[model samples]
Target: MTSSVFITGATSGFGEACARRFAREGWSLIISGRREDRLQALAKELSSQTEVLPIVLDVRDRAAVTRAVDNLPAKFDKLTALINNAGLALGADPAQNCDLDDWDTMVDTNIKGLMYCTRLLLPRLIAQGRGASILNLGSVAGQWPYPGSHVYGATKAFVEQFSLSLRCDLQGTGVRVSNIEPGLCESEFSLVRFGGDQARYDKTYAGAEALQPEDIAETIWWMINQPAHININSLEIMPVSQAWAGFSVHRKE
Candidate 1:
């Protein structure tokens, strides 16, 4: 039986890259995103290589998430992997200056949405036994914080800890949990964070060799393709151009 993988936020970036990568390897995919057109386009493009089920879903919507999972078709019901890639960081402003609404949006989608999907899918993954895995997309911001990270960093910190806790809970169930934290990836992430400002996005990545979405997709594939007996606990990847920043010091005027 061809293994099936369910990927959230599949319209673009890492999620989209994962969908394509897995499809090329002949894995059936259940891809979900808010943009119906983009999802459909991806499904169409990958249909020739592998089966694709496009779900127009916003992970932030709890009811919709539940319904989408509950209504999965019989063919795609045997899920072998769940890629929790539906998350974003909004605004580069400091906490006091940040928009409260953006904070709420990030919390809802990044934290709560991930919890809902993982909770709903655990049983199916367990049923599939040893080969099952859950790959979460975290960030370097979660580990090393910077000024503008704020709530976005907080959300990823939750994800990292959550993945660790989940690994403990799933110990004997033969289910694997891996948190994939990446640094300075070039994607729609900056664009979304800066609220569609092309200039800001360009400036963020200007003249830097950053990690690409395909790089992340390849990393995930490597993790999942590991021997069933070998479970990767967590992976933190960063490009050569990026590194830890020195602590900020306030100077006396």
Candidate 2:
């Protein structure tokens, strides 16, 4: 039987790239996103290569997520992997100056959303009786902090810890969980973080070489393709052009 993978946030960026990558490898896909048109377009594009099911989903909605997963078509019921790639970072202001709504949104989608999908799909994955995987998209922000990354980093920190705890819980079940943490990737990330300001987004990546969506997608593909006995717990990646930020000291004026 051909394997099937369900990926959230498939409208663009890493999720869309992953869908394309997996499709090219002959894996049937269930792709979900908030944008119906983009999801439909992606599904249509990938259908010729492999089976595609496009779902309009807002991971923040628990009931909706449950329904979407529970009602999977018979052919796509046995999912081999669930890629939790539906998350974002909003605003670049310091924590003290950050908007409360932005903080809530990050927590809702990044933490709560991931929990709902993982909780719902885990049973099916375990019951498959074959090796399966959960690939989470975490970030270097989770590990290293920046001035404006307070809530965004906190949410991802939860992801990293959660992924580890999951590995512990799923032990001996042949269900692997891996967190892919990336740094300085160029995508809709900056745009979303800056609230769709084209100038701000452009300035962020200007003259800087950064990782692409395909890079992370390929990493995920490699993780899933690994032998069942060899489980990769977590992988962190960053472009050579980027490195850790230096410490800041306040000088007396």
Candidate 3:
């Protein structure tokens, strides 16, 4: 039987990649995103291989979240996994000079949004009582605090702790919690962080190779597809060319 996956932030980056990868593996997908166009496009792209359901939602909306999950299609009610990949980095500026709106966006989307979705969807997984998984996307920034990534890093750090704690709490319930942290990933993260600053986005990975969305998605797939006895507690992935947080190399002339 094919497993079903419910994923937030499924329109782009790691979320989109995971949607495609899992579809290729014959998993039915429940994909949610803020952009209707992107969500529709993704659904169309994956419909050929696997069953795809696209939901236009903003994870920050608690009421909407509750309503959406409440109204899930019959097939999605049988979800085997939930991927909390719908978060964003607002600004990479020091706290003192940081934009309050940016900080709020980070906290709202990265932390509260995740809690809201997980809170609503966890009961379904628990009731299934077989084997289930939750994969949260974190970042190396969570481990290494840089000058301009104060709140962004803190958010991911919370994910790490939350995942560990949830795993222990769900031990007897047959549900596994895993956190995947990617360093220097190639994605819209930079554009979103800089508010669509083309120059800054261009320079983020100018001279070096970075982890691609596929790489992160593959890590998520592996964790979800693990043997029954094995649970991937935590995973941190960085491209071979990228060493660590804030350690990217520039072209030397």
Clashes of each: 0, 0, 0
TM per model? 0.98, 0.98, 0.94
Query: What lDDT is obtained when candidate 1 is compared to the true structure?
Result: 0.93
Top candidate when judged by lDDT against the true structure: 1
Q: How high is the lDDT of residue 243 in model 2?
A: 86
Each model's lDDT: 0.93, 0.92, 0.89
- Comparison by lDDT, 1 against 3, better one: 1
lDDT of each residue in 35-105, candidate 3, tens digit only: 99999999998999989989999999999999999999766665699999999998777689988888888
lDDT of 2 by residue, 212-253 (tens): 999999999999889988888889999999988689898999
**Cα-based RMSD of the predictions, in order?**
0.7, 0.9, 3.7
What would the per-residue lDDT of candidate 1 be over residues 1-253, giving only the tens digit for each residue? 9999999999999999999999999999999999999999999999999988899999988899999989998775567999999999999988999899999999999999999999988888998888899999999888889989989999999999999999899999888999999999999988999999999999889988999999999999999989888888889999999888788999999
TM-score: model 2 vs. ground truth: 0.98
Show where candidate 1 strays beyond 4 Å.
none
Task: Report the C-alpha displacement of residue 174, candidate 1, in angstroms.
Answer: 0.7
Of candidates 3 and 1, the better by TM-score: 1
- After TM-score superposition, what is the CA distance of residue 252 in candidate 1 from its true location, in Å? 1.1
